[model samples]
Target: MNQRVLAERARRAIPGGVNSGQRNVPGLSDLVIAHAEGARFRDADGKEYLDFHAAFGPPLLGHNDPDVNAAVAEAGNGADLCGVGVTEGEVELAETLAELVPSVERVLLTSTGSEATFHALRVARAATGRRLVVKFQGCYHGWHDSVSLNVISSAEKVGGRDPISTGILPEVLEATLVLPFNSSQAVRQAFADHGADIAAVIVEPVPHNVGCLLPEQEFLRTLREECTKAGSVLVFDEVITGFRHHLGGWQAISGVTPDLTTMGKAIANGYPVGALGGRADLMDLFSSRPGGPAFFAGTYNGHPAVVAAALATLRKLRAEPVHAHVFALGERIRSGLTEVFDSLGIPALVTGYGSVFVGYFMTGPARTYDDLLRNDANMFIGYRRRLLDHGIFELPLNLKRSHVSYAHTDADVDRLLEAAAVAARQAGGEVQDLAAASTMGGAVR
Candidate 1:
């Protein structure tokens, strides 16, 4: 069936024609990809698109990377859900993660980033003997009750207990304190008011959830210092920035180590895997031996095939110049986007680090979620639709960020720039001379 028909049929079985809420939004492209390889995916209708969403930021090596697939196949040869003892693949993955992330001394695996963050918070509470958890307003740790509030709330409800989903206990909301992102003073005030009861301060380092607003160096340093002084565990939720920003995660680039780190996404090259690692003294709480205070276990914590895929991904990252290539593509996209928008007399701001970025259709930089709210959302959504029409697939909505993958080539970058130029012209009501704008392609490069 075609994508629109498939979606309509899915709605009869699923809640909104999609399992993920982001995929069910209005005005999104009606596309159901049948197969993906390298930098593009083919829709059911046999149409191809250059993918910029990168499956919501997990396909760092792109779709169906041969090396990662081979490792998965090899691990699955004799793998079983024995559920009796540890697997060598899990141990090796742990060792690899420990060596890569500077803050991870010991590790525990989970199946999703949400579970990893939940476990990290549990360990923090058990170790600190406190119940209060502090998180930045715009930052997203996961969808769990503990860190779910304030992620996509309206401006007035920014610091309030507005749960992303219904049915969360009000008590769960009470235990979390939501503060504004990139504000050191707010962090200090929150810590001052409730430092003695604060268990952990979890942040996204680079809060990509709300379209990639960066943290000022002083803000992160302040978090590290304040958490240290107050005895509160600082958790860097690097789910989005883990290996995509740098080999060692954003914490390494920021030079501020957290007491706990939650990572997923690019770690397994789109496989189902999540990990929480930090100070051994803290991670040891998950120990099953007598006297351990915290509990964390998952049925598929380190499935052999998934762990093998993660190991293969990490090893390949170690051996290849993947970061340099992706970073260059990201920079090119950012600059090219700016040029396209400028040529059409449209206001835009392209911001992000390394392989991730978002284009906001507003003037000046967006430093907070509230700032992002100022964007012309309808125009941005229109621009995304235009890109899709031009065979450049980005996640729908203005607030969602886009990703550039290792599989994306210079030609892919050039094509995306060309599409953006055309999209921009269309959005600005300047499409009458699209042929002339298309001829101005070299300007973006």
Candidate 2:
């Protein structure tokens, strides 16, 4: 069946014609993907498009990677799910995580990023015997009630408890203290007021959820120092940045290690796997022997096939120049797009790090979520939708980032730049020279 018919059937069977709410885009909501391979996917109508969405950044090595697929197939031949005992693959994967991540002395496997975050928070609370948690605005931990509030809030609700979804209890909402990104003062103040009661301060070292809000070094340092002083768990939610940026994760790059780290996304190269790892003392809380207060159990926590895929993905990352290649492609796309918009005399900020990029239709220097509020939502959405029309797939939603996968080539980068020029002109109507616009206080880089 075509996309329209499939969409109708899905809407009847599924809640909103999609399993995830974010997949239900405005113009491209009916997208029915048939199959995907290296750097590209074909729709049900058999039209192929270069995929920069990368299924929201899980496909760092690219879609259906050969090594990962082979490992999965090999593991499937031997084991499916022996729920009672641990497998060799599970032990190896955990060891690999502890070896790679700077802060991870011990690790626990989970099936999804959300689960990793949930368990991390649970452990943090148990470790400190504290009830409150702190998270930054625009940093999404998961759909769980404790860390779900204050993400993607309106200007009016940016600094307040803007619940993303209803049904989260008021007390749960009150337990989370939301602060602005890049604001060390706010963090210090929060800690000063509620230091004794705060269990953890969870942050995405880089708030990529809002399309790459680079964390200020001082801000990250403050979090580490305060959490250390207060004896609270400092959790880095590296679900999006873990394996994608570096084998050691962003903590290695920043040199400010947290007590606990929650990782997923690129770890398994598109397979279903996530992990929470940290200092042995904190992680050992999950050891459910006798009177262990923390409870951690999952039937499919380390499914053989998933662990195989993760091991294969990590092996490729260790041996190959995967990071170098994707990082180069990412720089190429960011620079190329910046030049495209600059030449067109359109005010835009193409911001990202490593293999990620987001083209915000606004002035430059996007340091926080508030800075992103100036972004023109229509132009941002229009540009992505236009690129989709021209056989390039970026999720046509505001603040959603595009990825550069290992499967993408320099030629793919060129193709994206060429298409972006056209899409920019189409979406960014009647642009003025950036020089002139800057004089009027309307320019940034």
lDDT of each: 0.87, 0.91
Q: Give per-model TM-scores.
A: 0.94, 0.96
Best by lDDT: 2
Q: Write the per-residue lDDT of candidate 2 for residues 72-111, one digit (tens) a residue.
A: 9999889789787788999999999999999999888999
Candidate 1 Cα misplacement greater than 4 A, ranges = 287-290, 430-445
**Which residue pairs in candidate 2 collide?**
364-444
